[model samples]
Target chain A: MTDAVKISNRNFSVFYGAIQALRGITLDVLAHQILGIIGPAGSGKTALLRSMNRLNDLNPNCRVEGQILLDGEDIYQPEFDAVRLRKRVGMVFALPVPLPLSLFDNIVYGPRLSGIRARARLNELVERSLQAAFLWDEVKDRLQTSALRLSGGQQQRLCLARVLAMEPEVILLDEPCSGLDPISTSRIEEALMALKSKYTIVLVTNNTKQAARVADTTAFLLQGELVEVGPTDRIFTAPKDQRTNDYVSGRFG
Target chain B: MRIPPRNTQALAVTLLAGATGLTLAVLVFVIVFILGKGLPVISLGFLFDNPQEMGKAGGIFPTLVGTLILPLVAILIALPAGVGTAVYLSEYTGDNLATRIIRFGTDCLAGIPSIIFGLFGFIFFVTTLKMGWCILSGALTLAIMVLPTIIRTAEEAIRAVPAGYREVSCSLGATRWETVLKVVLPNALPGIVTGIMLSIGRCIGETAAVIFTAGASLRLPHSVFDSTRTMAVHFYILAREGISNENAYGTAAVLILSVLLVNSLSYWMMNRFIARRTK
Candidate 1:
């Protein structure tokens, strides 16, 4: 994993309308390291991922406070273009949602948005991205087909390829393999393992085993607060906090 | 429990008998009578060609064109605006007083009478705007009349798109506008199309609103600025004026057939588009 300062959220609090979703969350995602944020429902795991790119800003009642820095630059600073930030900090969702376009279009949507043209260039990018996501052989022949027609597992990989094609330095994945079968889950884990070499990976997942299998570091969150964060081995085998121990031991979420 | 098996059977029979005798009979009778008295005089030429062969009282060609052209124009104006408004309400616009007020206004407009819409259309489109008694005036009136339905239905459809989809889009670093355009709109296309079809159907059938704004003329409209007649208006004029009873029947049949054709085509097109998308 490459070492560089990437995304760091400092004392960030988020509210949905009058309800507080995240409370004073502070975290640092190192460059090229897979950071796993694990928590039960409503622990603000997903909210943290969204806040990185200011996706929560779409909600009129949603309000955020404190600093979120990307490469030591304040992302919330007005001069920083949110649109451009999103293009550089791409994401994959829990359920596969390839935009209702052809598979080829789905893979190249981000690059095209960033003004990448030339059929040869796009074709190369598509092939590389699909290969990176381990989805090329299954979908290469039918890239022209609608992305919606693919099986759920294939759709998820297609979404991964889509994000990869943008060539973003940071990749945010929110429970990327939650809905897949065992083989599909293993494929995604393999892809994420390969991806961490080049991209800074921040993953939010409920699967403790999956987190241990792929993450360099693991954070345990409960009730919208980060309880503990450390190396995956330390967090799982020897958690410093009691809550993290209970969580990792399956005693309580 | 078995004290009155015969009585229970008798009660069921009586209840179903009353429903079949009263409710079903009225519905069947209404449809049969309307179609029975309205079908014989309808012909191909009466439907497709402009109503120019027999003065203002014979053919309904101009009216047919007017009915199709104006509503289609109105739909062209309303589809994007209505769907955009719905997207704003469902996806972008927050729960604010302005959004609430717009929703309330739309609801009120939906309940307003078409005659009142005609009066408003006359004063606004015809006099205040001085658009004259043209098809543009008529189409503007119809668009305003149908806007509420389109907004309400489209809003519901947009709202029905699963939150998971929106979350997925946002998480993918799609800006709010991109998410709404690339994800929400495509997912909600079927429902939005249904709303448009409903509005089109209403616009085609409406006469009271078009009557005051769209002057009763038998000539084909070369532009939206030209006054024109519609099939519904022709049906009314033929039925009321002492022209010929057959003309009225033929006009009504033509109106129904045109509406059917529009509805069928919309259904086919939208279904095909959705099927292709899913494929």
Candidate 2:
């Protein structure tokens, strides 16, 4: 991965009404790297990830202070188009919510909204996206069938394929494999590894093992505060913070 | 052998079953009585022929036509307006004071008496708008009456759509309107159709509102501007005026049959649509 920063948050703080979810957090997310954020519940991992693409703006009471930059540009600027920003940075939620549509249609939904109307192009895009998510082989024969019929793991992968179909530069995943079985989780991890060459990935996971397995860089957040961030091996083997060492070693959350 | 104490639960169950049986018996008896009295008078000649001697001697063909037309026009006016309001209230707005007030207003509208709506329609459509005592005026009145039902039901349906769909759509960069149009509406369609079916039933049976806005003219309406009478109004006048209880019973039977037919057809269509969607 290049050392070029794709997204940077400087003194970023988030508040849901009066309750602050994320304290002042400053971090640089480099291009083409998997930045795994390991945190316990209520550590603001989701807030930080959502703030990158302005998804937190959906909450009326959510307030953001400080700058979140995407590709060296302020994403929270008055003139920044959220719709366009979202197109550049896509997200997959914890629960796999496949649009109540056909498998083919779900993949094409993003492109169709962006006005890609050509049949041949959409067909090519759907195939490529599903392949990237490692779902093509399983669903190729029944692309027209309802996406809801897929297994839980396949649904999660389908969601990943949906984001990939948008041709986004970055992907934000919020505990994407939290509900998946080990086999499904491994498949998703494998897909992410293959996907890192083309897309920057930010994964917020409660499972430290998942971070260890897939991430290049790891950041530990505790109680809305960033305790430490470093290379995965170093963070795992030689954490500087006592809390990180304690949490990673299963002493306490 | 165990001695059973006083079985209060069994007694209560028996009482409840008896009440239910009595209610069903009454309903069946009324239906049977109506059919027996009205069947002989319901010949093709009695059905299709025009009324003679002020609806005392002839068929209710014109009344049947008016009954069909008035409700059709009412549904046409109310469905779009009601569903649109429902979508806006449920989907576009937040749960602020304004939305709460609007919901309150809708509930108040639902509770208002049909007679009051008839009076308002008479003053507004019949006099102020000069629509006259015609089908259009009646339809407009009934539209207002049924609007609340449609709005409430449609709102519930729209709200029942899981919030996850909206989030997913937004994450994919779809605009709010696109998500609503492509996802929300399609998922809420069956419920909306159910609300409309209820509205149709209410429109068919409504007499007070139709009587005030649509004059009891015993003739087929040539246009919306023409005065007409519905089956319910015709039945009411026949029975009240003591002209022919026979024709009144016949009209009642026909109304019930028509309502059954409509309900069955709509349910069948809805089931087919849902089946195809899932398939």
Candidate 3:
């Protein structure tokens, strides 16, 4: 992985109403690498991931303190347009949502909304994005078919492909494989490994083993606090925190 | 007294089926009775030719034209405002005091009687605004009457769109307007169209409100400012004025058929929308 920091969260915190979900987090995400966040329920993994893209802005009660920077520039600056920022940072939700449209239209939705109206360019984007998500061969025969008809696994990959079509600089995934079966999970992991060479990825997962299998650097969070973070191999085999050790060894979650 | 579970199940099914059957039977009976009394008077001449002598002879053509024009005008005026209000209420505003007040106001408007609306229209549009007993005055009244329906339905439709869809759209860098236009509007189209269709039906069948605002003139309306009589108003006059019972039935028959046509189209569209969404 490159030493260059793609994102930095300095003394970052998140609160919803009276509850604090993330507290004073300071972390660096290296460029062109997968940073996996593993935690049990109520550990604030999703909140931290959403904070990267400012999707938390959608919640009325959500409040943020401190600063988060992308490429050494503070994202929370007054002039930063959330819409434009989203173009640079795409997100995939846990459950697959295919927009109830034709597979072709679903993939092209982002580009079309962004004003890429040329039919040929849109077609090229659909093909390229689907191939990158490893969904091209399966769905190439029926591009115009309704995306809702696809199987669960296919729909999830289509969602991934839809994000890919945006050509975003960073990809934030929140428990993307939590609902998938073993085979589908493996496919997603493979796609993520292949994609990390091009896009900075932050993944939040409940399955710690999945993180160990794929993440270059893994952070273990507990009750909205970052207990430990290190290279995935060391974090798994020889973690610095007892909680991380206990969690990784499957003694307690 | 405890009843056997199987017997209770059977009794509940019978009661529910009987309720449904009774409602359908009443509807069929009313439709059949009207058709039986009126179909003989309905000929092409009766439909196409202008009435002679206060609708006692000739045909009901001008009233038919009025019925068509009034609703068309009302829909053209009301659809954009209604849907716009609904989008603003559901998407832009959260559940708060302003939205609650707006919703309560809408519900109150919906519950007001048609004749009360007629008095309000006569006072506001006809006299106060000086629109002068014309199609425009009448259409404005109908537009106000149906605004609640259209707003309520459109809001429900927009709200029914999966929240996840909005999240996805925003994540892809779409502006709020872009998300609403491309994602929310398309998904909500069938419901919005259904609401408009139902509103048109209400407009077509409106008699009390139109009579007060749009004077029952037999002359064919050349413009929005011209006074005209709708099918429902014509039916009321012909029946009440004792002009010609035959002509009155004919007008009632035509009005019923047109209302049925619009309603069924809306129902069909709604069913298709539901099916597609579920699929």
Candidate 4:
């Protein structure tokens, strides 16, 4: 990867009312690289990913201290428009949440909201996004069908295509494959590997093997604190932290 | 293993079945009695002709027209207001003191006696506002009376929408209002329609409120401001005064049939909407 820093957090901490979710931690996400975050439940993995796009802001009592910068700009500044920031950074959730709409409409929903009204352009965007998410061949003939009718895996891929239609700079996936079978999981992993070339991807997963397979760099978080972060191969083979070593080797989460 | 006593369980089952059978029997009895008495008087001339000789000799066509108009006007006014209030309460506000008070106010509104609503309508819409015994006054009264039902049901429906849908919409950079209009409202439509249907039933069956606000007039209403008599009000007057018991039964039968028709239509529409959504 290039030397450019796509996103970086400096001493960032997240609190929900009186309860803190993330401790003061620093990390850098390099441009055009997949950064995998792996941790067990209550480890703040989802919290960290949500904070990147400010999705955590939806919670009324959620508080963020310190800085989270995207392209060297503080995202939590008073004047910063969260709507615009979210447009630049998109998100996918654990379960597939296709809107109650057709597959074509789902892909065009974001674009339509952004004022893209040309039918030809929307059709092209749908095709390109589906192709990128590797869902075109499966769903091309039934583009006008309801998205809810798709299988669990296809629905998840449709969600990826929906986000991709916006042409976001960074994509945040919060356990995107947690609800899928192994074959579906592998399909998504392959999509992630292909996606890293164009967008900076931040993947939070409970499955460590998934991180090892697709992540260029993997960060291990435990109990709201970063245990270690390094090149994926090194982190898996010989982690510097004992906790990371034990966790990666299936000793403990 | 010792077998449990079956006597009490069997008695309980028998009691439940008897209760259900009793309810059904009562419903059938009422329908059969009304249809038997009213069907003889229901003729083409009786249905279409205006009442004459103080509503004792002719049909209830004017009252039927008034009945239809009152509910239509009431629903047109109440639906948007009630649904808007529900959306505000469920989507925009938090569980704060103000929200609690708003909810309490809605519940209170729902429990107020229909007679009290009638008095309020007479004072406010008929006398104070000088609407003066018209369909509009009656409709406005009914609208306020049914607002609570609409608000409660619509709020429940809007709240029932999955939070995941909102999160996904927001992540796609849709604004709060956009998310509500595009995703939330469409999903909650069946519930909203159900509420409206219930309000329609209430408006149609209401007698005391319409009597006070909409004066009993045998003539058909040409405008909203003209005095009118709904079927319920007409039936009550005819039966109470011993003017025409046959016409009263006939009117009651028509009212029941119309209510049933409205209910079935609403349910059919709601089922279609839900089916399309799931598809």
Best by TM-score: 3
Residue-by-residue lDDT tens digits, candidate 4, A115-155: 99999999999999999889999999999889999999999
Candidate 2: stretches off by over 4 Å:
B1-26, B43-47
Off by over 4 Å in 1: A17-19, B1-35, B44-58
| TM-score for each model | 0.89, 0.94, 0.97, 0.96
Better structure of 1 and 2 per TM-score: 2
The total of clashing pairs for model 2 equals 0
lDDT of 1 by residue, A120-214 (tens): 99999999999999999998899889998899999999999989998988899999999999999999999999989899999999999999999
| lDDT (tens digit, per residue) of candidate 2 on B1-279 | 644556777788899999999999999998899888887778787778898887789898999899899999999999999999999998777799998998899899999999999999999999999889999999999999999999999999999999999888888998889889988988898899899999999999998999999989997889999999999999999999998888889888888888988889988998887666655
So what's the TM-score on candidate 3?
0.97
Better of 3 and 4 by lDDT: 4
Interface RMSD of each: 2.7, 1.2, 2.7, 1.5
lDDT of 3 by residue, B1-279 (tens): 899999999999999999999999999999999888888899999999999989999999999999999999999889999999999998888899989999999999999998998999999999999889999999999999999999999999999999999999999988888889978988888789878988898899889999999989999999999999999999999989999999999988988887887778777877787566444
lDDT tens per residue, model 3, A110-207: 89878899999999999999998989999999998899999888888999999999999999999999899999899999999999999999999999
Evaluated on chain A only, model 3 obtains a TM-score of: 0.98
B133-167: candidate 4 lDDT, tens digit per residue: 99999999999999999999999999999999999
lDDT of 1: 0.85
The DockQ value obtained for model 4 is 0.70
How would the docking of model 3 be graded?
medium
Error of 2 at A194 (Å): 0.7
